[model samples]
Target: ALSMPHGVRMRRIILPQALAIMLPPWGNLLIELLKGTALVSLISVADLMFQTRQINAATYLSAQAFGTALIIYYILARFLITPMMRWAERLVARRLGRA
Candidate 1:
């Protein structure tokens, strides 16, 4: 997208809409990120799920971790995804000459 001109029709029209498509996909990405984190053993990447399991093995804070992750996803969808959707709506409107 950087290769395209800023504020020009090609970039602003195309890029923002495309990026907003990613906005909705972030729900899937968040679920995937957490699940991907769970694959530390196979992927060789140490992550939060492994840490949580280790911590639970030691101190057993299962409920807290589960609640925190839920809240995090909710906040992300609210604050992040909603804004992108709004922007996408405006872009679509502008493209239709509604704005």
Candidate 2:
């Protein structure tokens, strides 16, 4: 309010602050989205988990099949989504002058 008039304060101050505060939760939501994608297999979609289930059924190798799925999911989250989320958080921090 002191830095700007009421009308411009929302655009200049509130929105950026809101976005910066939302970054961490937004990253968590992304990770949840990745986990939720596994549910697509319940509807007969041929996602990674679905294929792993099929392989386990065919080969009767539950440990191998499920282990591979777990490893793949870990790699996807650790190498891809996690870094992207961290980068987004850092970018928000920098934009908000908190970095």
* Cα lDDT of model 1 by residue, 1-99, tens digit: 566566686666776566555655665665566455553344575665656667777877888876665675567566765676677667766775667
TM-score of each: 0.47, 0.79
lDDT of each: 0.63, 0.83
Which segments of model 1 are wrong by more than 4 Å? Answer: 1-50
Estimate the Cα RMSD of every predicted model relative to the unseen true structure. Answer: 7.7, 3.6
Candidate 1 similarity to native, TM-score:
0.47
* Index of the highest-TM-score prediction: 2
Tens digits of per-residue lDDT, candidate 2, 31-85, equal: 7877777744555766987798899999999999999988877887888878998
Consecutive 10-residue window with the lowest summed lDDT within model 1? 34-43
